[model samples]
Target: MTVFRLIITLLATSILGATEGVVTSNSVRLTDGETLASAMDKGALALNMGDVTFIAGYRQVTSIRQDPIIMRFDGQGSDAVKTWQRTDIDATAVDSRAVGLIWDGYERLYVLITVDGGSNDAGTVRRFTNNGWLRDYGSGGGPKVTVALRVDPNTGTPDTGTYIRARLSNGNTNSAVPTAIAFHGDTLVVQLSSFFSPLRVDRQRMTHDTGPSPFPWRVVFDPSLANARRSEAVNFDGVVDIPELPSRQVRLMVGDHEDASATVIVNQTVVARPSGSILDSGIYDPAAPCSFQLHDSIPSSLQ
Candidate 1:
């Protein structure tokens, strides 16, 4: 059997620290001054609406907290385009679940939504900025709750549109899932499962910026992998920083790669092996919780 390995080294400064938290309940309460209208202008309020939760890391809250309360934002303002209605959607009707919240160094908020209904397992990510909400591209037919957010090297801020990478399972007999994503400045590195093609890493520059008008997020892939439909892998249950790199590095694991196992290392280590091969792996940081259906398949070693 032949194995393909691709290694690329990038020169970058250490990664910045970020505030992280999760919202599992809808009991979050808001104070009198914490209405959506006021919070929108202040850009420093954390509110939870049903399955959606908003966290304002710019406010520099000493600690993260989710209170129980009912709050509403009535329509206001003449912008017409700017309605007081909240953009944080409640997906309970469809049985969707909130994975977690990530605050990048620039204080950009990214929310992961996992939809695991009788039909399919898929997900969507919403980026919250002072300007407004920016939705991201997502997959269908498989569980895609795993995600990773990296700072936009161009502006050094995520609001300007940070690099958002996600993975989903294709339910194929062969293990094909998005493995890892890494950002060094403006360049983005993405890894996915490829059946016929040789083992290789692809790079592309994409613009995730949004305007006042509604628009969907765009992802530009390297032309070489344009036909690589095997991007889907097992859902990632968690993410953590590689101790060696400490900063600017993260390891994502797919609990089970179709009975076999697999791992993707972004920035430093990128390896490709046949499906079902086992390798030494890192621990999953509970800080970054992901929603997927492969929980029962996680190897006993990783558990």
Candidate 2:
């Protein structure tokens, strides 16, 4: 038997932070009031809409309050795009943090949000059309509830209304929280997990079922945000992180173990293919091969 180990190390060569490069049209520069450093300090995220840049971040109002803000700047007039506000439904303890912004390249701009609902958090996907945000998406015009769908063997257009607001929760109110979200082609991949001690699924215990430990699971949704398909418990016992790949396939980092194993979910199918291992000090050991470092870099271009 051959074991494939995967390891990724992000290095920073600057004292300011880690630097990421994005090539955009010259017209897509930030206004004078905002700089790249300031955006990074605010934990802002930017998405390119046409030639313009759509920035999403939050402003700290009080210790327990934050206002989600969006800015549409094209080196010009008004930087304020729109202000978004949502009161907790049923007044049952709700807090939100912007996870990402998704644009369909035509009209819809989706905002991925995680709602902290005291005990169990939810992964909410909201849609903003050309007019404004769609408030009446779910029931009486709010977040659409999660439903069980027939898992199709292949992909096809969903037969339901466009899911302007979709929330992912599997009834486990104790800990089912959405940790991260990303786009796998046109499909949305959401990483979800509960609050419990995880039973590590290392090379030694891959065959045995680790029972009901908090191993991160995934839910894949189509472009409409409807027709969700859940995946099996990933063997690697860690929070799933979806990194960008040239192939645009969903890369699931196994866990923060020395083995550094990973599986790829291609297209919309849940498949695990172990990427090859590395030779560390000319010896083979599953628990001695993974290392990670985060470097926060500020771009000098100020865009």
Candidate 3:
């Protein structure tokens, strides 16, 4: 009789353990505009919307929604990507490109807008957070800036007589002015006018060698560097190594100088070529042959 009682007790204990292990599956279907709190109130461990799913864990909602909001301007043609509207005001413009979109985890979204016209005076970046719009104006005020270079193609040897020109986004240009040119340790520097600032230039890059035989060098601008801005002249402190060759050349190209109009300047010569014609010098023939023949033909290469 005691053994029978023991068997019955064991069976009861097993049933109790089974009941404790059981869990109720709690989930809720959410609409497009439902809050997380409402889903929690429904005893939901997960919320399923049309095409999105949010999982709840540790008393927190684990899903974030990020959708690009596009605004179209009237009379701006059908190309949606190239046009934009100002969130601050109800103004419509054309050729305003949406450059970037960013979402902050809590409740903020940012949109980077670029204007195609000469001088990005109309361009603005907007932030959407806390149910309102915020505008950010980039660096616009600074002292007059100038870039100078002291370039040495190789150790103990420095080249001379380099020329440079700057093109502004407003269709204005500063031609290859000898007075505006300066040098510093194997780098050619161009002194921009007082009106031009580093913030005004959207992008900058260097081309090792690409032009005519004498100074066969060019600087190609990378559009990706548009956001990279320097308030003052860029200092070259031997950070960028120069090739130890007489034919070694370097050119600096700045794109969208003066605004977001895609203005590009080609001739910002730094470091002169070794003395001697291209035919006479084997260095020019193989080491630095002209890559940009079409641009070489144009006296003042401006685009």
Best by lDDT: 2
Which wins on TM-score, candidate 1 or candidate 2? 2
In model 3, the runs with Cα more than 4 Å from the true position are 1-94, 118-303
- lDDT of each residue in 1-303, candidate 3, tens digit only: 111000001111110111011011221333323344443465534323232223221111124311111222122113212123222210122222222222211111222222222223332112111111111222221111111111121121112111122333453332211112211212222223222212222333222222221121112111121121121222221213212222222232233221111211223221222221111011122222222222234432222
Roughly what TM-score does model 3 have, to 2 decimal places? 0.19
Steric clash count of candidate 1: 12
Tell me the tens digit of each residue's lDDT in model 1 across 135-196.
23233433322222322222223332211233223322111222333322212233333221
TM match of model 2 to true structure: 0.39
Instruction: Candidate 2: list runs displaced more than 4 Å.
Output: 1-41, 76-93, 118-172, 176-180, 193-208, 211-214, 235-303
TM-score versus the correct structure, for each prediction: 0.26, 0.39, 0.19
lDDT values for all models: 0.27, 0.33, 0.22
Going through the candidates in the order shown, the clash numbers are 12, 9, 12
Highest TM-score scorer: 2
